[model samples]
Target: MISAVAYGWKVTSNAHKNHETEGFKQRAEDVDQKAVNIHVANIICSSIQPLQNRAVLNCIEEKVGPDEKFPWAKFRIEKGFGALEKLLKDHAGRYATGDEVSMADAFLAPQIDAGIKRFNVDMVKFPNFNLENFLCI
Candidate 1:
């Protein structure tokens, strides 16, 4: 059983590596666009993650209550998404950066996912933002 589990883990790891390698190759093909996407992703991370992450939310809920944390997280995510939307409007293609996938898309996709799934953020409010689009790439 142990050996079978180990083999399964190795296979999964290899598949993940292959997928990542393909993504990297796509990003490399458009260096300038990828850089822009990465910059936008950095902004998203800096502006939102600090306030919306699980640790901070847990701390807020512990200190105050669950109701309080939701409002706070919603406000921060909207603000961050506003900026992200503007950036996306200016530079976004099929993905956050451009037609090609990049580190920026990689970073922002998960953040949006967490925001919507965990915090119940209303993503539809951001006209220019689409988590599905980013994730598909």
Candidate 2:
């Protein structure tokens, strides 16, 4: 559990890529909001979830936290995910690009679920990010 959340934290880290793609095509403004970090993180982390299983949710608050982003290297997870929740929606939504799973889905699975329970995040603020995270496998 601690390991799973930590993995998600790593994916959500700042260094992860949320870069604008497709020639920077966006709706409101530049797609600086775009992110691929959660996807990769979820994928790897989600795979580990079964091992952690019940232990994962059992160890939030301390193991996982709020007000920060994920880190590939390692750091304070609670603080990192704390910052990330700010940019996401509370509920997971359909895949960003149709039904097919992308790298982003990987990170979102355990992450959003873990985030909601661990940090008490309000996903409305981070709409795009929220929907993706809210959805289940």
Candidate 3:
């Protein structure tokens, strides 16, 4: 079972690599943009999303109280969103990095969606995230 899972992960990893290779092939060659993209991805994947996942939420609820989860998630989301907003302030155009969708947009899109849909994050607080473009997409 473990071997099968590992094999499946390897296959999926290869597919994802191909997808990213295709994505990067068409992407613009801007080092600053790449840096920004990675930074945003790190913030969302590492800092924000982990805290709000079911396991963590459940742990918080189990350890503290059920009522504590929402506030904990809200605070983390807000802090991360605020950081993202400030980070994207100078670089963002119609999308996170530019008019055309780039690496940052790829990462930002789903996180934004989750923030709005799952966590009920207030969009007004993160104005510079260019929600209009992402929402339409």
Candidate 4:
């Protein structure tokens, strides 16, 4: 995740050069906003991924058995999603951060995809979250 965020910053910086012009100034602002969004998304992903990892799941399954493992994962994910939903609801524009696709979207896309597809999480429960729209973005 750190690598991914670092890559995102590098890519964004290289792509959106801060030239001295009115148009470039606006572009710079957009790039800055994207960096902020990516940082926030990275923070969020860092918080959640640890709880959802194979080792964590294995521990839970060993302690509680296979039948209860799904519930454990679901509970943790839902809790994390609740906090994320609040943040996104307050600040989201078109995607997790804003109108453009940023690092935040990049981080969230695969997580959400896996949560919905692999875990069968009911994403509809998060009314503020637009998974389909975000995925499109």
Best by TM-score: 3
> Could you tell which candidate, 3 or 4, scores higher by lDDT?
3
- In model 1, the Cα lDDT at residue 106 comes to 57
* C-alpha TM-score for every candidate: 0.70, 0.35, 0.78, 0.69
The 0-to-1 C-alpha lDDT of every candidate, in the order given, reads 0.66, 0.41, 0.72, 0.64
| Candidate 1 structure quality by residue, lDDT tens digits, 114-136 | 77887788888876665668556
Q: Tell me how far the alpha carbon of residue 134 in candidate 3 is from the true structure, in angstroms, after superposition.
A: 1.0
Model 1 scores a TM of 0.70
List candidate 2 stretches off by more than 4 Å.
1-93, 96-99, 130-133
Candidate 4 ranges with C-alpha deviation above 4 Å = 1-39
> What's the ranking of the predictions by TM-score, best on top?
3, 1, 4, 2
The better candidate by lDDT, 2 or 4, is 4
lDDT of prediction 3: 0.72
Would you give me the overall lDDT of model 1? 0.66
* Better-scoring candidate (TM-score), 3 or 4: 3
Residues 1-137, model 4: lDDT tens digits: 55544554555455456432232121225656655565556555666555567888899899999999878787787777777777677657666766555556656666677678757788888766667676673
RMSD (Cα, Å) of candidate 2? 11.1
Q: What digit string (tens of lDDT, one per residue) describes model 2 on residues 30-79? A: 23324433433444453433323445434442365532222211233333
lDDT of 4 at 127: 69
